[model samples]
Target: MDFTSLSLAYPWEQLPYALFAIILAFTIHEFAHAYVAYKFGDPTAYQQGRVTLNPVAHLDLFGFILIILAGIGWAKPVPVNRYYFKNPRLAGVLVSLAGPLSNLLLAFLCFPLLLLADQFGLGYKGIIELLFMIIKINIVLFIFNLIPLPPLDGYRIIEDLVSNRTRAKMSQYEQYGIFIFLLIFLIPPLNKLLLGPLFQYLVPAIYRALDTFWSLFL
Candidate 1:
């Protein structure tokens, strides 16, 4: 969960870019949830003003502080009343998928800008660095939130897919899920197992794909 694990060298110098990227990523992510839920006949989040782009509506104070200090954080979850949906299971899955997919979309949109900056040698190192950070952070958010564990969008998707009895069994251990999530990162072997493929293979592969695709135009 540490941003430093993303190999962001010069932590202090990159802090501003990281903060900006985090805010954008978290805001768009949460807004997507709210928007999709509203469209699916759940106005719960929209009624609470969660559908807006304002970061204030989405940023959780403690999570924001944790992210600033420790590089791990989260936003306030958008409230959705599944009872309003005609198909609660399908709507729930889409609502959960919305947040992570928004992040991936952000990364996809930003990749071209990063490529353009590199192609033109913009000379504005700060701008180039900011774009890079945005792309990287959004990609990280997209992948991280999709990990099938409790408190993540992936788990919500799973909950929607599973039978009621299975979901009830999952709920029995829901309270301890966050603790287990943290333990995975805190334990060295587990951390390596989780992050190794993500950083070594998936991330680089994504970047290469983006590069190849964007190189066609830029």
Candidate 2:
């Protein structure tokens, strides 16, 4: 199937590159969550077979389709049993943080390689295009998941830090968060207030940081 047909900007030839980026981003993010949970003594994800890099292990069919259609999506959430942790609070925070952190780390590593590909002209056209998609997708994944909304990694991190009563309150709204998210995107004013700065400012800031870091060594 021609995935690029879904994209209005890029040519159809770039479909493979975009698909690779989405799969890699989703796989690593979920794997990091599962791995961290296992490291912290939670065996739930391991038992459920999520502690692997296989994209199928992480991808949610509906979410992947949304990614292709709208430039954003999600993966299956790794099952984590925090009660197994020696210090549930610390372990919980770390495990929840791993997913987004993995994406940021990926963006960091890809930036320099992207520069080299561009400078040396190594398969410049396709390779550079692939790396750019990979970097952008990873950054978007990292930032998007950091919103302090229920069911997202960011809210889990907050759940670990905030009082138990507050966590309970947040948990009550968890089921409605996705519906609320869709509404935010559908409503222009809400979308502008919430997502506008993310794309316009934060994303560019990260790119600038990547460029500055590589410039120092080059």
Candidate 3:
């Protein structure tokens, strides 16, 4: 999606902060997936070294560029083998949820730090901006990946919830899902109409949750 629709004002000075935030968020997200998969008996991701916090291990070159420019992107998907799980469906669902859940948890964990930065004005301008960007971008990544589209973590969750027949039908369209996402995202009216509300509500709501937590102590 275009950055404009998301109202992502990327000033030149803020690029470094934004870039760091994306890398940190993406790394944690993918690592969570790999870690959960390994715990659930899938050794593939762990064996491939995906269960680490290294951003380079998870960043997809094109996806990272898109995240910098367009406000939404992906990382390398952690590989999971159904055969490894005792209950494949449950394991799959938990593994899929891990990525976005990790982002949400990270955002929550950053709330106090964000409040401290605002209250005490800790660090220089870029440092403060980086902290805020970390919270916002992690929230965005969490919500965006839960859109129930193929190749996204959400779809795997959806797959577990649906009937076998429906799952088969949805699987058939998986290959074309990214193209469909691009078609909707690149078009102005469609992007604004569809994703705009998500930005307006979903994002602010998350921050508000963090705010509510901060209010308890502040």
- Against the true structure, whose TM-score is highest? 3
Lowest-sum lDDT 10-residue window in model 1: 1-10
- Write down the lDDT that model 3 would get: 0.86
The alpha-carbon deviation from the true structure for residue 55 of candidate 3, after best TM-score superposition, in angstroms, is 1.1
Deviation in angstroms for 82 in model 3?
A: 1.4
Q: What is the C-alpha local distance difference test score of each model?
A: 0.87, 0.86, 0.86
Q: Please give the lDDT score for candidate 2.
A: 0.86
Error of 2 at 138 (Å): 0.5
TM-score-better candidate, 2 vs 3: 3
Clashing pairs in 2: none
Residue 202, candidate 2: Cα error in Å is 0.4
Order by lDDT, highest first: 1, 2, 3
Q: Candidate 1: lDDT over CA atoms? A: 0.87
Error of 2 at 68 (Å): 0.5
Comparing 1 with 3 on TM-score, the higher-scoring candidate is 3
Question: Per-residue alpha-carbon lDDT of model 3 for 3-36, expressed as tens digits?
Answer: 4455443766788888888899989999999999
